[model samples]
Target chain A: MSIKLTYFDLRGRAEVIRYLLKYGGIEFQDVRITIVPWGNLKSTVPFGQLPIYEEHGKVSNQTIAITRYLAKKIKLAGNNNWEDLELDALVDTTSDLLEKVVNFYHERDTERREQLKRMVLAETIPFYLSRFEAIAEKNFGFLAFGRLTWADFFFTTTIDMLDAMTGMNVLKNYPHLQGVVSNVTDLAVIKEWREKDKSSVVLANDAK
Target chain B: MSIKLTYFDLRGRAEVIRYLLKYGGIEFQDVRITIVPWGNLKSTVPFGQLPIYEEHGKVSNQTIAITRYLAKKIKLAGNNNWEDLELDALVDTTSDLLEKVVNFYHERDTERREQLKRMVLAETIPFYLSRFEAIAEKNFGFLAFGRLTWADFFFTTTIDMLDAMTGMNVLKNYPHLQGVVSNVTDLAVIKEWREKDKSSVVLANDAK
Candidate 1:
C-alpha cells in the first residue's frame, strides 16, 4: 500500500490514526503487529517505535504528529491558527490523561498500584475530566471549538483505553465529555468502520 | 503586558517560547516566577500549570502548542502542512528524550536512579541522539527540514534542561546535534537575549 500505518495490535497508541482514517474516508493500510518479537520492525523504524505513518514509503513517527497531518489532509484541522492551537492544546491535555492512566496500570507492586489507582480515580481523573467537561459544555459538545475538529476524533479514540485502564466508565460523571465521544462515534462512517472486520486483535472494549 | 509567558525561573519548558519570540523579533513580557508557593498564580492559570502564553488577558497552555502558535505567527513554521508534520514530529521526539531524562532524574531510590542513569547514558540517550544526529546531518544542521524551522528552536531550547538532567555533556559525541544547538543559540538575537539582564533564578549552567 502507498499509505500505511503500522502499530501494535491493541489500541494503545495508534487508535487515533485509525479512527481519523475512517472518519476522513481515507483508504490506507492499517497494519497491526500482534506478535511479541518485533525484531526487525523495532530496529528498522525511527526511534524504534510503532504508530509510524508511511506515505508512499516515506515514514514519520510520533502519533500526534501523524494524526495532525491526517487531520489537516482530511480538512479536520482548525479553521485558523488560533483554533488549531486550541485543538493542539486540548489534544495534549488528553495525552496528559493518557500518561497518568499508563503509569497507574504499569505499576508492578500491588500496594503501590492500588494506591495509584485511588489517586488517579479520585484526583487526577476528576481534575482533567471536570475541566474537559466544562470546555465541552462551552464548546457546544466539542472539545476545543464550537465546531468539529480533530481533537474530538483524538479524544474519543483515546477514551476507550482510558475506560479499560480506570476499570470504570471514567466518563460517568462528565456528560459533556460523553457528548464529545458520541459526536464522533455517531457519525455514519465511524459507526460503519467499527462494524466491519476491523481486525483480529481489536481491543475487547473498543467494540462499543 | 499585552503579550506574556509565565513559567518557573529555570529554562526548562518555556525556553522555546522565549527563544522564538526573540528570534521572531517580537516584544513582550517574560514573567518568571521564582518563589515557592506560587499560590495565586498557580490557581489562576489553565491546567494550573506554568509556561502559559497570554495575549492581553487571554491565555493558552501546553508548551509545544504555545510554541507552535507562536511559530506560525513568527513565520517559523514549515512551508507546507507536510513540513509542519515533520517539524512537529521532530519536536515531539525531543520531548520523548526529555521524558526519559525526566524519569531518570525523578527516580528517588538511589540504586534505581543510578541504574537508570547508567541505562540512559549507555542506551536510551544514544538510541535517540544517534537518530537525531543523522537527521540533523541530513537536514543540514536542522532537525526536520533543511531550513530554520521551529524544531531547531525547540531542540536547542530543550538541550539546556537535558544537559542539567543528564549531568554531563549529552551532545558531546554528536557533532551534528551540537551544530543544531549552535545554529539556534549562535543567532545574534538569542546570544543577546542570553547576555542581557537575564532572570534572577536562571539555572547555574545556563549562562554558557
Candidate 2:
C-alpha cells in the first residue's frame, strides 16, 4: 500500500503520527507543506485541515484519528475495548493540555499571553502531568496497560512540541513523564529517525 | 455489568453516551449532577471532569473516550480499521464545531459573543456542514461507511446540542445532515427514550 502523511513542515500535530510510523517501521511518504503554500493547499484536503493520512489514495484527517489508526496497525493500541478506552481518555486529556498551551501561544496580547503562560507552566501542566506521572508510575513507565500504547507516544511527541513552543522544561520534575519520553525515544527506530529528522532542532530555533 | 454515567444535569456532553446506550439496548445509570452539587463532587472523580462512565467499579473520563468505548461494545464502531479512522475523523470534526459553539456561549463580552455566534452560525457551520453533507450524500445518509456508526450518532447528538446552545437551525440547508439526525433519532429505542427524556424539551426551551 502506498501511504503518505501530509501536514505543515512544522513539528506540530503531525509529529505524533510520524513518530508512530517510524517506531513501527512503517514506510510512508512525508509530505510537508510550508506556511506560504498552505493557503493554496488547504481547500484541496478533506475538512480543509492538515495532518491527513492517505493510504492507497483514500484520505483521512484529524490528528488523533490518524494516530489511532496507525497505532492499531502498529500494535500500539490496547489489548481490549476497555483498555483502548483508557488509552483514548489519556490521549484526549493530554490533547486538552496541548490545546491550552496552543491557545497561550496564539494569544496576541503580550501581558495576557505571559500570564497564560505562567498559569500553564505552573498550574495547568502540573495538574495534568502529575496525574499522568501517577498513571505512568503504575503502568511501569508506560501511559496505559503497563506497556507501550499510542497514548505514551502521543504524550511524548506533543509534550516535546509544547516544550519547544513555550521554551519550558515540562518534564523536569515529573520523573515518570521523563521516563515516557525516554522510553519512546529510546526505541531504536525512533532514535535513528531523530538522528535524521532535524524538525525538533528547527522548532527549538523557531522558539528562540 | 452495572453501568453508571455521571455528568451535569444538562445534556451537554453526556447526551451522546446516553443516546448510544439507549440505542444499543444497554442498561446504564444516568447520574446527573446539578451545578450546585458539582463543586462538592469535582475532585472526587478521575480527572475532575464530567461525562464519566463507570462499569462495575472502574471509572473512565473524557466524553469521546466514553462514547468510543460504548460504540465498540455495541457494534456502532466501524467494521475495520480504515472505516474506524473515517468515523473518528468525522466525529472529531463535529466536535470542533461544538467547541466553537461552546466558546460563543462562554464569551463574557456581549459584543464579542455576538460576533462569535454570528461567525459560528454563518461561516463555521457551513464550512463543516457542507462537507458532512457531501460525505453523507455519498454514504447513503450515514456519516461513515454507508451505515450506522458512532460518528453518525455523535454528529446527531452533538449537533442537537449545538442547535440548542446557539438557537440556530444548523441542518436547514443540508438535507443529508437532516437525514443523519432523522436516521439516528428514528431508532425505536432512541425515539422511546426521547419521549420520556425531558432534557430535549428543556433544550428546546433554552433555544427559545
Candidate 3:
C-alpha cells in the first residue's frame, strides 16, 4: 500500500513531510483537505490534529514524527549507526522552534508579537541558523555530512515556514541558511513535483 | 573516546539522556557543568542550547535529539520497524507539552501565574496526559506495544520535572499516568540513579 499523508491542503504541518518526499524522490498519496471540508475530516485524525501518516496499515501522528517516519522510509535519515538518530533529533529542533513561532503567531498580541519575532530573530533563528550554517560549512553542503539528512530538509522547511507565516525574510540575515533553503528547494525532483501542485500551502511569509 | 553530554548539570534537558544512559546501563562521562559559565560554552552549542551529545567524535545539540541518539544506542527504541519512530514521536509530543509548561512558567507574571496554571491544568496537561494514558492502556503497560520506548521515560521525566518545579501534582488527576510514573521510578536503575544525584535544579515560580 502507498503511504498516505492526511492534512489540510495547507502546508501548515504536512508541508515539510511532503517536501521531504519530493526531495527524496519518494511518491506518496498526498491527501489534502479543503478548508470547507476540514470540519468533517477533523475527527478522523488522532488527537484531532492533522499531519497524520499511514503506511502499510500502520498509523502515526505528530508532524515531526510523521516527517521522521517518512525520512526513515525514504532513507533520507542518515548513513548508519547513530547518524539517523542525530538527523532525527536535528529535525526535531526545527519543529521545536516552529512550535514557538506558531504560538507567537496565534497567542501573542500586536504589542508582544514584534517582540516575540524579534526574540526569535535574535535568539532562536540565529542559534539554529548559525549552527546549520556551521554544519554546512563543515560538510561543505550537507547538514550532517556527505548525505542530505532529514535535518537539511527540516531546516529549509523551518526557514520556509517562518517566511511563509510572518512575511518576514528570516534568512536574509543569514545567507548560509538561505543557501541551504535554496539548495533543498532547487532539487530537481522537488522542483518538478512542487510545480505540479501549486497548492503546497506556502505560508503567507513564504510568499516573498 | 567516551561519550560526553554537556548541559547545565541539571535534569531539565539533560536528564532524559542521562536517564537513558542509566536505563540502558551505558557508561559515559557526564561532563557536568559546575557553573553555566556561558561565556566559555555559549559558542560551542548549536542554537546556544544544551544537552549536546558527542559520540564517534561528532557533536549534536538538542535534548530530544540526544535522547533519541541514546535511545538508539541502548536499543530501547522498540522491537523493530515503525515502532521506534512512533515511540519517539509520542515522546516528542509529551515533551512538547512539557515545553509549554516551561514557557508558561517563564512568560507569566505573578498576577497571571495561577490563571495560567489553571489553563494548563484544564488544557495542555490533561490533553496530553489523558492521551498518553490511553496509549499506555491500549499497549497494556507501555506507551508503545510490548516494549518500553523513550515515550515512557519522557512521560516519567515530565512528571518528575513538574513535581519538582510546580509542586502542583500534575499527575494526580491522571491515575494511569501516575501509575506509569510510579512504575518507571520504581526501576532499580532509575531508583538508584535518582538516589545518587537527587539535587536537581528546580525553577521556582519566583525564579524569574
How high is each candidate's TM-score?
0.93, 0.94, 0.90
- Candidate 2 deviant stretches above 4 angstroms: A200-208, B200-208
In the predicted model 2, the residue pairs found to clash are none
Place model 3 in a CAPRI quality band.
Answer: medium
DockQ, all models = 0.78, 0.81, 0.59
Off by over 4 Å in 1: A197-208, B197-208
CA lDDT scores, all candidates in order: 0.84, 0.85, 0.73
Alpha-carbon error at A9 in model 1, in Å? 1.8
Q: Rank the candidates by TM-score, best first.
A: 2, 1, 3
Top-scoring candidate (DockQ): 2
For candidate 2 chain B, which ten residues in a row score worst on lDDT? B199-208
Q: Best candidate per lDDT, number?
A: 2
Candidate 3 Cα outliers beyond 4 Å, as residue runs: A23-26, A35-37, A40-44, A200-208, B34-36
CAPRI class of candidate 1: medium
Mind sharing the TM-score for model 3? 0.90
Clashing pairs in 1: none
